[model samples]
Target: MTCKRALTAYPELLSRTVAAPSWVMPGTVRDNAIFLSGEVDEVGLCFFETAACLAYGENDLPEHLADLPLGWHVHLPGDLPWCDGGAEAAVPALRLMDKVAFLGAHRAVLHPPVGFADGAARLVAFVRAWEAAGRNPEDLCLENIRGEDLTGLWRTLCDLGCKVCLDMGHVLSYGQYGLLSLPGLSGRTSMLHANAPGPGGRHLSLDTLDGAGCGVGRAMCALLPDDAVVMVEVFDWEGVRRSLPLLETWFAAQR
Candidate 1:
């Protein structure tokens, strides 16, 4: 079945960092806002990199963002190893969530740490901390990462009453390794990180979808509810531009 959902573009679309030997200047939040003003329905901000900008008294840009008519979403930093750092990690995430709440963001996408041995317990503690702080658990979305055994992680999130941010590219990568069976997870999904997966887990433009990636993308779109949000998660302007049409076509076909 086809569902109607809001489409958003990642901030990387306005500007992104290039690798060594290449000097490509990234755009500021203001520049990005101006570029995407009339382009999409919402913008996905990377909190890991922009948290400093939202610190006390640095509200000029965020104030402008609040004035915009578009929706807002936050992507938490993946660098914080919640599983290993215990309270240390959870604290920062909580702080960021506070900022997300302040911005009135619809949701915040989060990633489980890389080597989370005690994933379940760690997540429980983290969620408890979030709850104690009076943050809305529904606004926190746990995303599936590459090469991780997300089954237990998913269960932990579900138990805590949190939602999911299904990253299509990561799912496709997992499927490649025969680890892609998530039966009831989609029902709890509130957002989607839309992108096509390439070799070595690279995020590619939706227009670059190979046969398998295309099928996965279509399946995801079909599964999401009408109120779900889809963020084009590619990292460059060209990729975002190319992916938008493909996403529109997919959404149209769904109807």
Candidate 2:
């Protein structure tokens, strides 16, 4: 039976978004691009910058795009506002979430800061604010970090009854670094983050495929139920373009 209480999606994003994007309410051309990105390079730059519209104005957001799909989302920065103090963080975040809700987003995929003051505290404050705004714990999708001192954070979130947006590449890279692992996480996951790696020990530009993160990507899809939301977390569009085929294969191979 289809899960009604659970997130409604494409098997790719409800297959993934609308809830995530609706929070930001960018009203961009709603497309089923199950992807995410950053600025280290410039692969999915438009998508990144567009997602960053959370920090931008909302009036223009509704009027800018001609078509806003139902499920669109933005993976906000750990600092999110990335502007100033924690007290001010909630303002922009709330704005973003409202916009997402306005635009009909399905999820707001977020990662705690690379170096946070405290993981538990940060999550507590965030969730409290969401509750204050009348949002539920299920609305937020906290991601697993790839770097230092965060192995147990996932467990903490699991303990809190929050959803897990596990990143396969990070697990692999963390595993390679002896920092984290990929065990005991088979069924208790809500979504997956993926990317094939490239040179420079960096995630390949999602624009151009350099082929590094595929190992973990392949492994992650194999573990899931084949219809899980696997955001192709790339740097730019090149990475996004190249990774799609690989992801499709993963989707097709499911038993």
User: Per-prediction count of colliding residue pairs?
Assistant: 0, 49
In model 1, the Cα lDDT at residue 89 comes to 64
lDDT of 2 by residue, 1-255 (tens): 324222222233334321221211133332222121111111111223434565555443543232322234546555564334433455566666566555455456666545565646666666677667776666566676655334556666666556656665566545643322444455555566665444555655333433455545655666664334555565444554455556655555663
Alpha carbon lDDT of residue 161, candidate 2?
Answer: 57
RMSD of each: 6.8, 7.8
Over 4 Å off in model 1, which ranges? 1-25, 49-62, 100-102, 176-181, 199-201
Residue-level error in angstroms, candidate 1, position 52 = 6.1
Residue range 130-240, candidate 1, lDDT tens digits: 778777778788888865646767666777888877788887767632324566765787887788888776678888887777877877776776667777777676676
- Please give the TM-score that candidate 2 achieves against the real structure: 0.64
The number of the candidate with the highest TM-score is 1
Worst 10 contiguous positions by lDDT, candidate 2: 36-45
